[model samples]
Target: MNIIDKTDEELLAIGTPWWEDLIKYSNKGQYGKFIQNFSTDLLRGLNEVEVGNQFAKSDLTRSLDTNYDFLGFIRRGEHVSFLFRVRSTKKPGEWLGRMVLGYERGEVKIFAASIF
Candidate 1:
């Protein structure tokens, strides 16, 4: 399961361990880093809040409970993006996600998620 590419199969393969780690990592108070690496500034709301480590497992589970599926990727400039949609859900249908990445030296950070 590749975190950078974020394919459907990879998201599905994430399993429990990866999700647990992700929750811990984000809740540890690095949400800005997570946002900067996961979603791009091009979409909207790039930086308006502080990382307060407010992510909860219930919220994550609720978000993941949707039937939305990772369809594939679309390339735009330095970003490679993916789309997830849910038709049967009560919420809106159009939500977009992109992978934002930055590199310094050899340190790698992950900022990938479905921003809906």
Candidate 2:
């Protein structure tokens, strides 16, 4: 099924596991596992050194509070951008987390992910 055609609940179901893996691997500083489901374009723009640097320097990327609140999503073209109200396990404020999902070579993959 096309990702963009899925309902909100379905999209959440599809994205939740990937999102969880992202948080889990990120907290562990496992760069490979963290980008396992990333799209080609995303992978092309990232590298272990860059990710490691971010993980080392950014508190938001170091350890995220797993109890994130889903802040709905926006569909644009072939992608669905999911937003979450996230917090840092080591910090004390809310941040916005975004994950954009779409099909790549017939498989669902993350085109982008960020915390701000």
Candidate 3:
């Protein structure tokens, strides 16, 4: 089935693993693994240098808590945006992590992702 056709619960199940990989690779500063499931357009816009710099400079990216809370999701056209409540292992307070998923080349891929 097409990814966008899935219900919120189904979509969350589908997206959780990908989101976990994002957090895992981000904490380890593994750019390749981090971008492995990114959409073509998203991959094209990223570079190892910038991503590495961000990983090095941001405490949040390097210290993400894996035990995150799945807040909910939003469906827009061909995309499903999942929201996560994330915390830093090395800091206080929480942050919002958003991962937007869509189909690319017949597979689910992350079209956009951010933490704030």
Candidate 4:
């Protein structure tokens, strides 16, 4: 019931919207919409506003830059992760983020998102 039937490239392709949505929601301050995209395990029933604030920073929201690219991935048995390199043109800064997505309960769910 795993959701990783597609190739590595395909898996990466599926995550593009996730990355975009993160930046978009952060900028818009739509806490509800943002956390809704996360897996139930990620939220753990915590207050969605706090979780959204934890994921986004005020600096990131101030910048109009929203460009990111996939650098590569790491595969360790069932653990598959991809690193995205994000750039802020307004401030001329860069940040790398790592997102892990895998199958749980016959579905592909995002497990974690951390700064790389």
Candidate 5:
């Protein structure tokens, strides 16, 4: 799916893999791979809050039980950002996620992911 000059369906397609890979990568403690989904600015922002540790902890602790929801989308100039609402049946809100799709380096990037 295209991020630049994308349709809504394209926007939808753009974020799914990143979310799935986020789970897979985080569970494996592949922090570099996990952060690769984001832009440098987003990475810097998340690090300031130590979210990677929380995400890794959640994934490593409950790798089998984690789940995510496609909550909705947000619009930005030249970007089609989507949100993923993550939940764990074990601890409903502990690892709640809000993720978005935006462009970085001329490609679609899963730019923001935060627990809520």
Candidate 6:
């Protein structure tokens, strides 16, 4: 289903703290979710790799970016763990550390993130 048509229950099931209503209206495209949640550098890296897949009409890249091998998720109370890596294509093998997103009270806030 399209973003506008998705039910609140379905959005809540995804387990992010940002309320469905807040997310749905904040950006025209849900693709911006990544940009909204991540840092400028990270977003840039993602853009370079086409992580949001703006060129393609699909959620495949966004989903993968959020839940990848190195990047995983875990639900702990009000917080949903987010884990992911960032590496520059130009740098090749040079990779960055994992990051996490803390969710609480309908807000998907970054609790503690670092370059691991």
For every model shown, what is its TM-score relative to the native structure? 0.35, 0.93, 0.93, 0.75, 0.68, 0.31
Q: Which residue pairs in candidate 1 collide?
A: 37-111, 38-111, 38-112
Question: Which residue pairs of candidate 5 clash?
Answer: none
Candidate 3 clash total? 0
lDDT of each: 0.40, 0.89, 0.90, 0.67, 0.64, 0.39
- Ranking of candidates on lDDT, top first: 3, 2, 4, 5, 1, 6
Q: After superposition, how far is residue 96 of candidate 1 from its true place, in Å?
A: 3.4
lDDT of 1 by residue, 1-116 (tens): 23355554544443223333433454454454434433333326443342242343324323432344556555444434445443322343455433333222333233354354
> lDDT by residue for model 5 over 15-57, one digit each (tens)?
7777787766666666777788787777667653465556556
Cα error of candidate 6 at position 102, Å: 2.9
The model with the greater lDDT, 3 or 4, is 3
- Provide the RMSD of all predictions against the true structure, rounded to 1 decimal: 7.5, 1.2, 1.3, 2.8, 3.7, 11.8
Clash pairs detected, candidate 2: none
The per-residue C-alpha lDDT of model 2 at residue 36 equals 90
Tell me the spans in candidate 1 whose CA falls farther than 4 Å from its real position: 1-49, 53-62, 86-94, 101-114
Q: Candidates 3 and 5: which is better by TM-score?
A: 3
Decide which is better by TM-score, 1 or 3: 3
- CA lDDT, candidate 2, residue 41: 96
lDDT of 3 by residue, 1-116 (tens): 46668987778788999999999999998988898888999988988688899988998899999999999878779898899999999999999999999888888889999999
Ten residues in sequence with the least summed lDDT for candidate 4: 55-64
lDDT at 3, model 4: 43
Query: What digit string (tens of lDDT, one per residue) describes model 6 on residues 1-116?
Result: 12223344543454344332222422234454534555344444554445334425433221222212344555555444444454332233423333444433444444433333
Sorting all predicted structures by TM-score, with the top scorer first, yields 2, 3, 4, 5, 1, 6
Tens digit of per-residue lDDT, candidate 4, span 28-111: 777666555567788785776666566466565535356677888776656568788876546666778777777767667777
Tell how far residue 78 is off in model 6, in angstroms.
3.6
Better of 1 and 2 by lDDT: 2
